[model samples]
Target: MLRARVELRELARDWRSWCKAIAEAAEKTLGSSRVYVFGSAAEGYATGGSDVDVLVVAGRLPRSFRLRGEIKARIEEEAGLPLYHPFEIHLATWKEAEANPIYREAIEKGKIINAQGLDSMKPIGESFGESRGRLPDRSLGQR
Candidate 1:
């Protein structure tokens, strides 16, 4: 039983390291973006079968949904992780993230893995006008 526990710990460590690598790759892929780890991974309850949940909020991204996977692919490639890696990576523009319930939950409950140098950009979901990749100011009563 003790041996099993030790092995589980080692496996968890490996998963965390891999998640960190993916986060780093995402940071490089989307410059000036925020990367967060949510779900079991962020809560430190991940098991061997758990999928790493990552949320990446960027100032800009291709508007088409079809092109989103292309960006994620770049991060996977940079991380040396397979496209089928046990990761649930999400890419969101600041506006999209602000409007998305799942992204909101992740932002609220997740851990920011690439905090260094992330503060140079404006706060997430802040008013930057209706421009692409920017969140509209809800405080102004603009829908």
Candidate 2:
């Protein structure tokens, strides 16, 4: 039983590492855009089977399934993770993130980690709005 518990803990650590790597990869793929971790991964309750939840604030991505697929492929390749890794990515313009209730709530509830330098990245979502990747000026509990 003790051995099983240890193994489980180790597996969880691996997933966290994978999540960090994937986040970095996403930043690289999106260039000046920001990649954020939320849900299980951000709160640090991730387990081996847990899905890595991510939010991407970027410029308009082509609305093509093939292009999205290629982007994911690039992330996997850059992160050195297997293609089948459990990564669930939510994409939006920074303006969309600020205006959407769901995104605002998630940002409030989830801790933002500076895996990539925020200053180094440009606000790619200016086409959507002027604000960078900042959430709307509100707390999670208010709404």
Candidate 3:
């Protein structure tokens, strides 16, 4: 049980880093895009199996859901996220996010990662349940 918990903590840390990387990559790729993380990852409730929920709010997006998905895939690729990266990405335009109750709620509670560099943002993994001294290196993904 102790070993499982340790692995879970490591996995949670990896997920947080991956989410931050995705946000950074998206900001670089899409100048007007903003990224936010919600759900377990943002709230410090994540476990090894938890999915990092990310919301990408852009200035504009295609009307077709399929096209939006394609754009999201492109962002993930630009982020260099692995095929198995544990992220659940939601894309929306600022207007759409404002109009949707669920999205609005998420925005209110989520951690905005791309508004500025990660250095300015609080350490997400450090708040993961217990205090783990210093944060792990800001490396991109799973080691």
Ranking by lDDT: 1, 3, 2
Name the better of 1 and 2 by lDDT.
1
RMSD of candidate 1 to true structure, Å: 7.6
- Output the lDDT of residue 6, model 1: 60
Candidate 2, residues 1-143: lDDT per residue as tens digits?
67655654554456546656766887788765556566776666777666666676665676777888788788779888753446676776656777888776556555443354434222233322435455533233211
Q: What lDDT is obtained when candidate 3 is compared to the true structure? A: 0.67
Which one is best on TM-score? 3
Q: Candidate 1: lDDT over CA atoms?
A: 0.67
TM-score of 1: 0.68
The sequence of per-residue lDDT tens digits that candidate 1 reaches over residues 1-143 is 67655655554456656666776787788776767677887777887767777788887899887789889888888877743457778999778888898887776566666534334222333323223344335455332
lDDT for each residue of candidate 3 in 69-110, tens digit (9 for 90 to 100): 788888889877765556788988767877887666666666
| Descending-TM-score candidate ranking | 3, 1, 2
lDDT score of residue 74 within candidate 3: 84
Candidate 2 matches the true fold with a TM-score of 0.61
Can you list the residue pairs that collide in candidate 2?
none
